[model samples]
Target: MVGGGALVRKPASPVGPLALLHRPVPEPPSSLRRGPLREGAWRSPLRSERTATLLGMWVGVAFAVCFATGLLSHLIQNPPSWFGWPSRPVNLYRVTQGLHVISGFAAIPLLLAKLWTVYPKLFEWPPVRSLLHAIGRLSLLVLVGSAIFQLVTGVLNVARWYVVMPFFFTTAHYWTAWIAIGAILVHVGSKLAIIRIGLSEPAAAEPPAAAVAGGLTRRSFLTAVAATSGVVALTTAGQTVPALSGITVFGQRDPRLGLQGLPVNKSAASAGVLETAVDPTHRITLDGPRPQQLSLAVLRSLPQHTVRLPITCVEGWSATADWTGIRMADLLDMMGLPEDAEVTVESLQESGLYRASVLAPPHSRDPLTLLALRLNGADLHIDHGYPARLIAPNRPGVLQTKWVSRVRAL
Candidate 1:
């Protein structure tokens, strides 16, 4: 009634609540609308199912290598009752631990590339479309999280940077590996179908216009990723592989740079055993049926035998040097003990988890086991356990028990 136009609109139709709810809403602009699905809809030019599958295959190989080597290292450190790790080929631990670290480093680039290829799927609509899909997605999340954690922590450990971790790195890394491996197994099983399809598809056609204009093809991108992994391995493999030592600027230790052509992880001063290790009053007490306490002079005068063995550390560095000392078997015999007798070697370090270590019958009886007093024809370096150290085949450098104070038969 007030205005002709306003009166006409009310008369045309009484807009009730039901009508208002059912009214046609104006469409948002195309920029704000969800677009129709199309092949290769991901914005990233590098995103492709085939590319992800290829990268995944390489990553799987790297994981397998890392897992096998890591398991061997764990077993070596904490052998079960039934396991018997070999003591020969003295560089066995060096090679395995080196492979473990190098493979892990190499996998970094592959993992990142693989994630980048499939990252778009992370934002897919309706994340939990089905029960199995939900399980798979959850497992993928675990796999990614654990893999990143393990790699980061392992690298930090290699650098001897313990300040970053709140827990023991070795134990936590070992357990998390099992979890990550289990998730990987499940993810592999779940995605077998997709993986096969992606791999079977004829190589992607010339990538989209964006990829062409950007000057990076899928093949070139994968090659770059592989090259990056290779570079990382080359830079660090020298820690174990002697051939690359001269060029491995990024290695944790230069095997030839420590006291007497070998690296020492913990110096005598750091271990707080310097005074005791170099003291003339120091004696190696042998406790057995015929107990004996021998000074350093008497130990050196005894039938000294020389064996070329490598001191391989858990940190993945090793160096072979001429070690001369009384054989453990010989010493056990002199003490009226059986050749296969189990013995505990105690260190003068006073503190640290590895201050004392037990040698299983097999290791104790190994002819290569020695109560070493000399390295490379010279008296043991102060940092190399001045008076005496234990050097045994297939034994971790830490368990070699520097500054030996006592050997007790068990």
Candidate 2:
């Protein structure tokens, strides 16, 4: 009142329901505000929100591609009633499985870069600001944990190194993918506004710092990260892309280095069917309307047809070979079974998850589906399912069922 202003009022205090949200954050004690929690701990210009956001976008895309392809592989291996896969295109599974593995490898470098760019946030003062903040941080733990687990397990699987994992890789990897994807969705939704701003705003160059020397700029850091990812993908993709096979440093199997000039995921000896596969008394049983147990000689005596088919493995390596065998459809016709009948192929393996595989009508009746007895020309290599094996178009190598012992109509 003493000044020129008349009837001046102080700002009204926040009085609504969400007033607590408007209150100032409490300051921490001196003892609690040391080390990374100190005000000047983070000063790197390269750790800007823009850099993190850009890397996160690439990480998100890679994870999405990896998850979609992985889910398709799982469904194909264990299809429900609603699912039905086609028998044409021959290389469908190969392409999908290869993409699944390659995208996963690409994500490794992108994720690491994103995490490094955002590392300063991990040490933010007064870590738990609200209930939502605590939940969000917890979700990040799950996200990072699951993402790391997936990449590690996937690399191990690709290398065929199963001894280190306590649980089955397929089952654990499949379930954890769901958790990782959910956490990523929640994180993305919560940061949508910040993400928009980070992407829209220009990345300004940081002023020169006397303390830090030779640190990477934001653009250069991003470029390096992208180049690393590209190198990883190009080197690993050779497992599926034949043209790049010569430079495949990380591929588990060579497309041209196994029995019969085709890669083999599991050999007859490893399957414990080595003796049984070549036993003179071995008989391939076909159970149907006209059940018959035919010996290897009789199987050879029956009508023979040759087809060039690729043995595509889930491990992302494939090789084409000339397979000679009895047509599955022709065998069904001779056994008085319907053309569309489904069947279960049982292998001579004493015990294994892939010892048996179920074939739906599409594959069972496909013209290229064969009870193969020979590969390339001569009798099948012992490791290539000597007596007889199931060879079908557009099917995973695991489901090709080596050392066939029986085919039962379902």
Candidate 3:
């Protein structure tokens, strides 16, 4: 008997051979026969394989998008020898990182629905039917655990609530993403047949378990879940999509609210560089074959060029502004560095994970890359990296390296 004392008919086995050798099946342990394991503990007709399968498909797709975009982001920040990120299509990082965050948010509802639909399975009796079944269940645990971790950490990171997280957000999130995606693939491969059956048209005589009179029909439930996902995406996407800013109740940053018509993730005060940035003795040292120290006055006097660029943050907000500064190529030329030289840009901020960033040859030589001195036709705001800051196309906001101190060829 299964749930609700319903008699479960068993298929007859061949009895002509080896009948006497077949041993009687053992009874399940007391631990497996109580609470949720009780015969009628879960009676919800809505918890069907079909509904679970549908929700699972959508969750998988959302995770796929997040994985792709997130991996791209990690690689760009920590590029390998063969990986070369493009410098063109200035808004490329903006769009991709935005989609990464939006998709992660959208997955929350779908993931919850999927878990609700299949939650009863977590209490299945005879949990380890075989070695293969044990392996499958283990994968499910990894899938659910890592998926939850990714979403929770992602949301916290966006909210800038790092105190609650015990581990380093970026490193933990990046590595666990691999585990989540791998488990998802294993789960999908194991459930291929069931997925196909669930997605297909129902048979004429199929039971109407999900058609409970007072509760939500399966179609209605699915529609509600999808609508919730859509709502989440729309509300939070204003961080990246300027058109929806008015309705963005949960966005981390307002594109229109910040220093010089742009959002500031890290201010000069927060970075502990306020006094250092304003000090008259400050000079950006360029260390290469021909070392030179250029003060703020010298940086401004050296032929200034203005180019429009967007600063895209990993948290998903982006803002574009006209940056006036000396081109990176020009700076490199002044240092007597070759065209393909790699450089490390340092900040005046005393300490932080991103106080310094290495600029690869492509970005170092790119004409659009600048050691910015002004924003929106005025001198750089103290919070927006006064004196000088690096502004490069298709680069993350963190890598912009505020409060110019030194640039060294690597």
How do the residues 240-278 of candidate 1 rate in per-residue lDDT, one tens digit apiece?
888888878557887888888898888888899868887
Per-residue accuracy of model 3 over 219-266 as CA lDDT, tens digit each: 778889999999999998999988988889667988888878998889
Q: List pairs with backbone clashes in candidate 2.
A: none
User: Candidate 3, which segments miss by more than 4 Å at Cα?
Assistant: 1-25, 29-35, 203-210
Off by over 4 Å in 2: 1-28, 203-215
Clashing pairs counted in every model? 0, 0, 0
User: What's the CA error at residue 312 for candidate 1, in Å?
Assistant: 1.0
Ordered by TM-score, highest first, the candidates read: 2, 3, 1
Candidate 3 shows a clash count of 0
lDDT of each: 0.82, 0.86, 0.88
Give the alpha carbon lDDT tens digit for every residue of 223-337 in model 2. 9999999889888888888888888877776777777788778887799987888788989888989999999888889899999998888877777899999998888887788
Positional deviation of residue 320's Cα in model 3 after best superposition, in angstroms? 1.1
Between which residue pairs do clashes occur in model 3? none
Clash count in backbone of candidate 1: 0
User: Which candidate order results from sorting by lDDT in descending order?
Assistant: 3, 2, 1
